[model samples]
Target: MLMLRLVIASMASSSLSFQEKYDVFLSFRGEDTRNTFASYLYAALSAKQILTFMDHELERGDEISPTLRRAIEESKISAIIFSENYASSTWCLDELVQILECKKTREHIVIPIFYGIDPSVVRKQKGSYGVSFAELEERFRDRMEKVHQWRAALTEASNLCGLDSKDFRPENKLVQKILEDISFKLPKYLSFNEQLKGHLIGIEKHIKEIESRLSISTKDVRIIGIWGMGGTGKTTLASVVFQRLSYFQFEGYYFLWNVREEYSRYGANHLRKKLLSELLNDESILRMDTPFVASPFINDKLRRKKVLIVLDDVDSSTQLEALVEGYYHFALGSRIIVTTRNAQVLKKVADDIYKLDGLNEIESLKLLNLYAFGKSSPPKNYAMLSNNVISYADGNPLALKVLGSFLHSKSTDEWESALNKLKRIPNKDILDVLRISYEGLDKGEQNLFLDIACLINQSFTRDDAEKMLDAGDSFTKIGLTVLIEKSLIECRKDNKLWMHDLLRQVGHTIVCDEHREPGKRSRLWDVKDVCHVLERNMGTAAVEGISFNMSEISKDIKMCHASFSEMYNLRFLKIYCDNIDNKKFKLYLPQG
Candidate 1:
């Protein structure tokens, strides 16, 4: 079985070497260590799906073969196992010389494994090593320079930092150490190309903040949460951080995406099995049509290994219980990064939380220009128009991306028309994501959010909002907190109610969705909509609240009580103007 595996690997390696580089190159004497430590090393590397070149055929030559030398050069790392009689083989010596030459010239990584033989013996040509060199000198007496080169390569290769078999009692322990050292130094950066597809503007600082919270330098297992509103780049930041840092110290890694959707669709049992199968690298589990049954074997296997896991788009407590809470005890130095819009969900599980924000002005502009103008900055003629779109985005990456894509090749007149239309109708893609947090709320919370949204009050205090909406202070405060935690709204330093422009647009879209007609809508905040309802006395019983900045209308416009007669359920009415000239417009109210 072992020989067959090696033959297959050698064939695969030979074919791969034509176009691909090996993750590691293993060099060892076949008779002394091939079936022992060398076999175990190759098995370990192969299990990790790390491509390795191993000479399955017996060594019979005094010089390294062309294919063997090319394999050494193509490999990113070389693991040389110096066992008893390792220096006896000329082929091993030739392989070592080639490995070291590549190391010196290509700056490749070379790992020297002292397999039961002290590194000092290999370094200084002591004991059996000296006898091996003496024999080599006798056999190659005419070519003494070749023997000198072998001695120099051994001394130099043995000086590298690597696993010493003496320290690791059980031979498997040494193999484990070797596998980890090679994995960490593999430099798997290119895989991020598929993970991060779009403009990565403004993500560096976020990645740094998340890494700080992860505490990767420590050995403690930590659950770090990337908490923020939907479409704020939490998932994108997590993906980048996972790709770059996950390979640094982790032994196994699995990135489980759409945890909420998957859990909801497949149930806890299936997700657990999927997690185990992927983390354990067991393909048979997936091949089974039924979900793999849970057992202590799953937990026991995970408990011993250090891994990096990412659970993206986690929304429910059930998902936390099944995926995270079930396997929270990963080995020390293990880290799990979870991305969610709900702070409460993360608060229950995460050891440290990084509150992610959307793009800032400069980043928003750059990202917009990338999608809109296909450059880092907008064309000079479109600078002002570009700023206008950025202002509408207000640092929200989703909105910037959607709006930029929408305005990609449109004319200036189209840009103005689209911006105007956006004020009345939010982008569907951006609105759908923003609505997720809002939809998770209960009926009361939704009503409260809609009321706040219709208020369009950038500075509504908690007390002022409750008094105006008549929702009671206690109810309003709790609803506001929930919105804040979900990141649908924010209570800034001024302690006033605030929300993202896109979120506010979401609220507008929702009310608009309740009814197509302006008068029949549950809330009326748009100046044109309210004016349409008032000027025509089209107010219907569906109207619950109306806010109008009369200063936006003609000074001579007049509103009478009969206009709102049908709006008997209208509980809140706000009509105010910014200037004294606004008071000239007349407003007549019904007598008590």
Candidate 2:
């Protein structure tokens, strides 16, 4: 099979090097079917942006022109519309022979549409086919070999997969089937670029997990969901799997990226139209104004087709329903893969849910090293700094890539400074991407997220964090669970509340955005900012929470009672004085 594919690819590259100019070559008897079925098929293919060569001009003689022969070789597939009186034309027979030869040598696809006829009749030259062949034989009795060759070519073409107009109820239905068949056979539908071949590290394991869940060898319709945080490479892993499975002989395939964003931008109906147009290979569906109207159309057209579809970055059940609602809408062997940040969205629909985690420590380091140094290992003297960056990234691929690229060509001192600055301030590029998931949270969930990101991350247990929030017990518990389901936070086995560093940074940035000055902000963590606020009595009513690292400040630190008076809304406060003696640190609070 491998060798056969190689040979086919070589022949296609060599013979149809100009296939970009046309997708299909049409051959037919003009008087028999040109204005009828042939014209409809050509228009249908063209509506799908399929460039087809259909010769409409009157032929001067029986001999095939050089231009016609070139068109036959340049096309990726040939659609021969064999109708009554088709065999009477010697020119049509000659074109059929050339199409068959090209199919044999170049491995080009050949689809025979028996218009108002039967395959056995066309193959055996019986009935009207036989009558037309008898006339041609009598007229060309001197060129007996030519007549025999035409007969053999028709027999070969009739044996392949094709549509019979009689099998379909109406002519338009047959035209649709022909379009579907040709679109499925065309190679452009499965072409994925190879730019990420080497960059997809640690994706094979995820792909294997998905494949096992898919069980492609079985004839079951499987819907698998891959849920993970943003920048965890969910889309990357899905794309890799899509490309690998494209080699399978499925009836159709589509990889739709950024489903949530697309639906939000163009509305659900537009997305539905786009999905249907790509799957059915007909762009006319885009005219539909609402998903309610397109849903039934999709179910009717794609019900029996075995297709593979990947819906990436989906955020809601509405989006899923708008595209692919139920398993019954597709064939038995079809497979659908969906990637999302919200696990709750897949709970009711996915047959099996795979929660994608960040890369492991080793994989994270290797990825950072590759991006920073263009290799899999760090430079000789930069190992410590590299390890620091890896520790800060905490296995998040986006953070590692951003930090690595930022520190790529810097000196040791610069690396140290950047690492230190990152400890206090996260990279904006990384923060912006990670913030998307946070921004999707509701107001209550956003408050809980900020609480964890700014103050409770890693330092407090889940129960302790919930107590600090001061909301009702049930409300706080459900909010935290929602955060976990959203991939924004996780509860460790040791009962600690954990969140990705980049996500923590995002939360901190959100709080910081409320006020440029730390004293005016709702949350304050920096020691210098805290001391400045205390020493200058700059505290404000806007401050909802404040924390001071006393160990990082002077032992002679003192605060005025008036500073605490100004913080009228402060509900949460922490003072870390590990290095200083208790008596040396003085705090003055007003007596209410």
Candidate 3:
């Protein structure tokens, strides 16, 4: 078997002399699957220019060898081909030990490929394979837990789609599929093409250093925190960074969204279940009473393994504390990236802080054009309006998106009207524009949009939206499609939906108008203490349906309600303020 592997390894001689690094290291017991499976796998992988390293010579001694250990360390990814008799071999066990050690030192990625045996048997130390590991641990009883940990790693990986040796030969379609899956899992950015599409613009020197830290080998948990104001594009910056990380290049990678919102309801258990189900790509077996199932699924599987995890939109230190305990549970070379609106959040979890600055004028214009025209440049006729709109937007991407989306198909009259409304409104907050856009929508669209938007007030699911909206495809698919294209809402990679705070504020503003019951809106407000009235009576007022006058509030206070509907509501609500929010205010109120 060793000879066969050596013969195949030598076939890649064309690139061998230049000493280019090997892409994959194939490990297996020479006796069991090497001759039958590893040999074919080696040839096929090598054909694709994926380097394979396998020892050909039979050593004189039975002792573990240093040559094999070094080979395992230098390789970027180790593919351990586990067969029935794999654990019985001292040579294979030694290789396994070294592979695991290198994994701990952040030296390489390890993938345990179950060729013929069941993964759970290895993980639980069951059957013949389990017995072999047990014997090895007895010899090295002091390091018994380490031995078991390697077994657990194999089992955890096996939970992800397993390849059967009998069913999948190296050249078989299944083998190719598995190889491609592994290729995707390998460290490459989320979008290699996009990264190369054009050079990154306006990225600071420190940002590069943060990315460099991610690239370098390290044992400690590396945390990068990106902090900025509400409209400063913290999410976008973190997204670009996540794309660059090529987390799939590693053995385990996960991107978690809205950490602050989810933690509040589901607590750590829900998050653990999410990580296990989403990251592992496993079918959820979550039960409230048996949350421990999710913990063991992750802890037993990913303990001490290098993983790239992204926790986005973290608002509080408690959120971070709940999700990630410390670096100790993660394998060496693990990297975590966090994004938040709070600097204190960055200070808490981040080893280094990157304060995300607003986009430069050119970048801002480009972003606006992307939203307004779906192209990189402004149209000839719309350039003046576009420039005017951009100036009013003041370089906030969220504002640009909302404003551009509202003006996307409007005529010159509409553009002037919208722009005038935006200017007169004073608040000009992006969410305010979104609110106005919501107000401008026809009743059906407005209702559906507000339903989805308000559902995000506490961060609900699409199913929740489905139940709340109750209007079939119009509300669920078509309405969501329209909202997303309009840039009013964003669907996270995780199944949950997200409404920009601006958009949520807009939803609040739009709901506080002609659509809602006047009495309910009035009950929440007190026009006498008008400033506090507007501030405290915002979201609930929107829900109860009252549009308040924007001009009545001071400039700063108006800015707080800078959503489009709020400004539009001002046109009507300003005239009615004297009569609203009074204890004597009375109107029909919806009841359960």
Candidate 4:
């Protein structure tokens, strides 16, 4: 029994050490190329103890072996080494397909090693992979459909630009370069994940102000409002306060997102249920029907309890009224944090309101430099261009992130072209900054953005999208592959793709602008234009067969339509139509 226990302990230690060290999962067919270039990479990475999982294929089976699938899924990163005749074997093709799917579902980083194969050849499924696939189709003539999916996955994988296995050198310079790239990316990934943790932005000064307001003897339900342009970090600041103060006098905390939308859509019951579930830590609010029924329950639970509640993105006083109902129900020391884009809304809830200004010029430059060139200080040669990019970004965090990621890899000419485009584009509202990310995409990726904007829901899967759009031939054309590369779209565990709300708005605006009338301003929810377009086309059935196409418009043509109505026909349109009244729709199209 003691010997068995020792063996189990030894196994556990080995597993933990293996996880702690490895950074990349290298998937290669041993017969194809692993003995040479891939073997060198494995040795180099392992020497640094940057853990790599290389399946040398000592074992093979008819079905995908369980060990290979687990390694593909579990690894933090997967690099495929595709050589000539790599896709010929069913074994290699299956692994390649699984890796592509894994890219969607998991945070499995994939870097392809194109060994003696062209990227375009991979994308279009020409040359070796295509020839191999053709022969397989003949062999499995009755099972052609199953074979076709494998073809699609192979073509998609080949299309992506991976480090060429031929790019390897015995001098160790290239391997060293690859290691440097991996190291540089690791910190950036960590920083982004940290930013996504949801804290209050620009709240350090506000913390002092809050401190000044508090006194020794008694306390009141202090309402402090943090107001700024959307995405200016108002909610983030309130979150910071909530995290810090909740442990102090506050016994309860509720962090609500999109408070205005929640109240308007679900009404008071939504607020009540959210508060109850959060405080009670239950999935449901038992013994409660209406919000009023649960009010006393909330008041009773929070009576003597000092609660710190953050109501994020509260656009109106109605949301305030629905939430606290006057603040008297809480204990004396309880505090409520309200965040908004409107200063007027702030005045209603806040004993004190803060107007969040843009970051100062120096800070703005610092932020921009960090993003654009991946350095805190601009390089001597690019000082002029660096300053220009920063000046244009306007100290907005969203703008900085957009410009930084877009220009990170481009040359001086690319940066200059981007700057010229920005000049033509008018200064945008906070959400519009994300549109710059779309402009940065290649034309194919822009099409993918259009499809995602018009079609994908919060949890829509890419498999369904590929199937619905018949994306077999044009997967590369749509830029879904590039979108993943740029981190514009994230894949969830269920194989569904998700985008940030800001990114969705950017894509939506791009499509709308492109499709707008030559000289008309695009009002996103314009009822008349919507009804007119639908009626003009004689509804969904008329436009059903025609594929929607949009061309870039000139800057002088400013008043462009930028949104659409959803139709069974114009599947591209996805907007809330309920906001338009029947009278307004009639007014938009008055006729016999």
Candidate 5:
């Protein structure tokens, strides 16, 4: 157990190290396992957002190159795939030597995967290894020391605990087990670049201000609430701060994204379990699931370990109460951050409230110019246009981003048309600013955008979306790319589609304004709205889609033939009930 703790500690230490270039360096014989086992392992690691180094180029000459050796030294863990012909390669043996050398000198971990081969054969230099070494000794009889070093490396690496492909029938299971063990060693980190969209335009000041409010020098527990309207960069600031502080003195860190949505869908118990599991680096906490009910007590372990927790897009105080109980029992030096559109959610719990407003005139201009021209200031010809757009953005970071990106590389005439349309939106609300971008989309893109916004949750997988939209190949081309290009949406890891919270709200608001009556809207998602439309048989031909959960309604209403008679244009629908016993459908079909 002591050695186990030490191993885990070493993993965490290596993971957080700034100098390591990769999570795992994959060393394998290209002729044998590169296409089969090595490819599977590399793909699994990449899917988990693990930075892995795999040499794809063919092995050229006798020994490993300087670049490959450096990769082995730079990686936190070296995963060696020992296949049937692995020892036959002079290059693989040289890589193994460098990998084991790093293991002895640095805080590095070595994982050996014996693929379709016995570890005893590797450790004792028998069978295929013996044949290869006999040939190698004959070829390099003058430099026998190199052969001895190669033998020692293989023997040492084979003794380490690793996955054996034969132990698990159906090789994918072994691949999954290896992935899990690798994850167990490293701390899970959310990539800031993946979330930030790579444009650090006007967020620096917010970062510094929040850092000051955190009072990191003090020993007291701190809860900083960043309250603002949508598209004001609340999530961005929290993410930046979380990334910066995660490497510091904190015992653990967890950033919970889309808090309100998660709470509504999974309940507070889910949040509690997720937080505990993340901070403890143990998924077993999730196995301790109780009844889906609220509770004030988190684990007692949190009281002794200082941690950093960021709850993004929180809408309710109850979510916090159920997760950490307002950090009442937290350890000293722990920091909690809550980003919410509703300030009331954090009012009772936060130590200091940082109300995020719009960027100032200078910051806004710089941000717009940065996105527009790839510099802090625009070209000489576009100064007035730049100023006009930034002033119209009214300091909202989202607006600045979308507008600048939208206007990039366009002709001056196109710029005038774009700015003219933006200026025509009288009120200049952030929503109005966002609407201008939405207005630029064609009819197909617009319909798909609205469908995505009104029908889906904050995050959804591509497969589910493709089925609903019947948008196999063209869905991405017509809608997803356009929205992403305009900075209205993003495709993150795992093919999950996510849009800014404000953009979703804009889509909802637009659908609501399609008609004051719910039945006239193109899509229906809300329980009350769907019920209002269906129960009264108020369905209209205008209703193109409906996503309803019958479990959300307290009582059942008979859905009959008339329920769909009017909805001739209802091409998409998703109506589900949580309880198996609640399924009911009464259709009055025409006589066949």
Candidate 6:
């Protein structure tokens, strides 16, 4: 066990140590290439938000400075532009030697761009390159060892695969090509597994199914959809497939996350421009005035490039049209994956759809144990409690994780109390995620959802709930259908209406948000709040409904006319008193 702990610590430290400070480093002769080609390249990279280090001033020395060396060591990639006078300066040669050394030592990426210079001349040390080296040899005759190292460095760098400026016609075209190459070579900045909170229980099977659906080896466009409720891990699954399939064989790749939220916040035009800019590797596309203007540009530019794109959390079909119209908008062999909570959105554009379901009981327990104990199974002493928590979570990944984390270090008694509390009040983090689908409902649907969440869940059938709600039978039926489609509620084969515990808590909380005081709230479910309102005569017009289980309360309670008089809009009230004969509970009414 001690050795296992040490191994885990070491692995974590190693992961942290591998972080790169800069995305790219620029190596060029300031006098020869800085003002023209180098400047343009730096500006383009900076506009794309690529972290780069470029020395703007000229360095006057034969040896590379410590600061420059550090930059080379910290950068993930280095771009060496070999101009006419590149080899003439000992400073440039020394920088090149350091970059190549870092490449050999750290497995860094080195891109050599022969700008208006012959690759053969640079590789063989002939022509202008030879002339510059001769001058360096004469000047550094005493340091002949250093001059030899510089010559070897240039030869090695020039031999690697690189771009030649002469092959690309216009300067802008050359810049675009370089950007595209960099995009292809750059490592993924975001890790899909990391976003999953380090738990991927039961994900491998889904990934394999998605991989078979992709059929990436075929030379045809494929659009696959992943649909599920919130917290179902749809985004995580799609991200894993994307990262695994996106290889250097593809021309380009882009992942656009939170399409629904971002589109709502920044509008469809912003998303369209961002998509074009990222896939095309050019930030200038962001200047387009509207999505209509940008669509043609995207079609013209990306139609020939085979790429992989993932659009996550899409809520509408319009977002799909604006980003990727259809097969005609992309090159053959391209693949597009869209993740959404609505199946209707996928029916319009997706050729294949994969619907995600909740985790199984065994997987749920494993996930909870991993979060609480950092292992695959709970400790022997806590096995029963773990099972109980899993039962309450009902295979929901988010709830299991939240509850496990909350009860991680608590004592046995605390665990019992926490579980009891969870039966009444849900964890805030869990409620937040479950509330997203609830917030998306219309007012009528929202009311119907609250009725199920607060009073009807697991106890009442669909017909019973419809009879209780004030909306007409047709409107109530439509609302219930919408709720079911959105995964907010489920109807069992027995015709009983059911809701996830976390979602039920969210619905109750929404009604609670009307006011902090119990009497001012639209709904009341907690015994303490109900007792306070009834005992203190705090009932008010805001109290629309009240539901409580009297058996859970130990003391007897009595309510007079004042408790019911102030509630002018009281619509429904339910009290489950199993010990009514033992406890003296009374409700008095006023004369009409």
After TM-score superposition, the amount by which residue 264's alpha carbon in candidate 4 deviates from its true location, in angstroms, is 4.2
Residue-wise C-alpha lDDT for candidate 2, range 149-214, written one tens digit per residue:
999988999998888888998678787777767755673322211212224666667878998898
Q: Give the TM-scores of the predictions, in the order they appear.
A: 0.71, 0.66, 0.42, 0.41, 0.45, 0.62
Tell me how candidate 3 scores on lDDT. Answer: 0.60
**Poorest 10 consecutive residues by lDDT, candidate 1:** 188-197
Give lDDT for model 5.
Answer: 0.77
Writing each residue's lDDT as its tens digit, candidate 3 over 419-516 gives 78764343455554335446435677666666554333335566656554553355566666556534456566765676654555455455455434
Model 6: weakest 10-residue lDDT segment is: 187-196
**Candidate 4 wrong stretches, greater than 4 Å:** 1-203, 210-218, 280-287, 295-297, 426-592
**Model 1 ranges with Cα > 4 A deviation:** 1-197, 283-294, 470-473, 590-592
Selected candidate, larger lDDT, 2 vs 5: 2
Residue 357 displacement in candidate 3 (angstroms): 1.7
Answer with 4 or 5, whichever has the higher lDDT.
5
Cα lDDT of model 5 by residue, 1-592, tens digit: 9999999999888755536688899998888987888999899889656789999874578878888977887788888899998999998999998888887767578889989899999998899999999999999999999999999999899999998888988888898778767754553222322223325556767788998999988999888999765677888889878866664447788899988779889888878878877886778768874653323444467677789899987766787768767465668899999987655667787899887877889888877876777666788889988888876766778888888788889877888898787543322356774575567568888887888887876556766676668644566455666565445665678888876555766788788888989999898988888877777789999999988666777666656567778999987877665563544533223233
lDDT tens readout by residue for model 4, 166-208: 5666536656656655554443333344333212223356555
Candidate 5 regions off by >4 Å? 1-64, 68-198, 292-298, 424-592
TM-score of 5: 0.45
| Predicted structure with the largest TM-score when compared to the true one | 1
lDDT of 1 by residue, 1-592 (tens): 9999999999877754443378789998898888877888898888767889999974478678888988998887889989889999998999999888877756578999888788999999988899999898999999999989998999888887877888997777788778767755663323322213344678877777887888888988899888888888888888878866665367789899988789878887777767768778886666667655656876787788899999998887678767876555577888889888888888877898888888889889888887887667777878989999989988888888888888999898899999899887888898888888888899989998898888757867766776677644567767778888888888878778888888888888888888779999999887778878887889999999998776776645456658878999988888877664735765555445
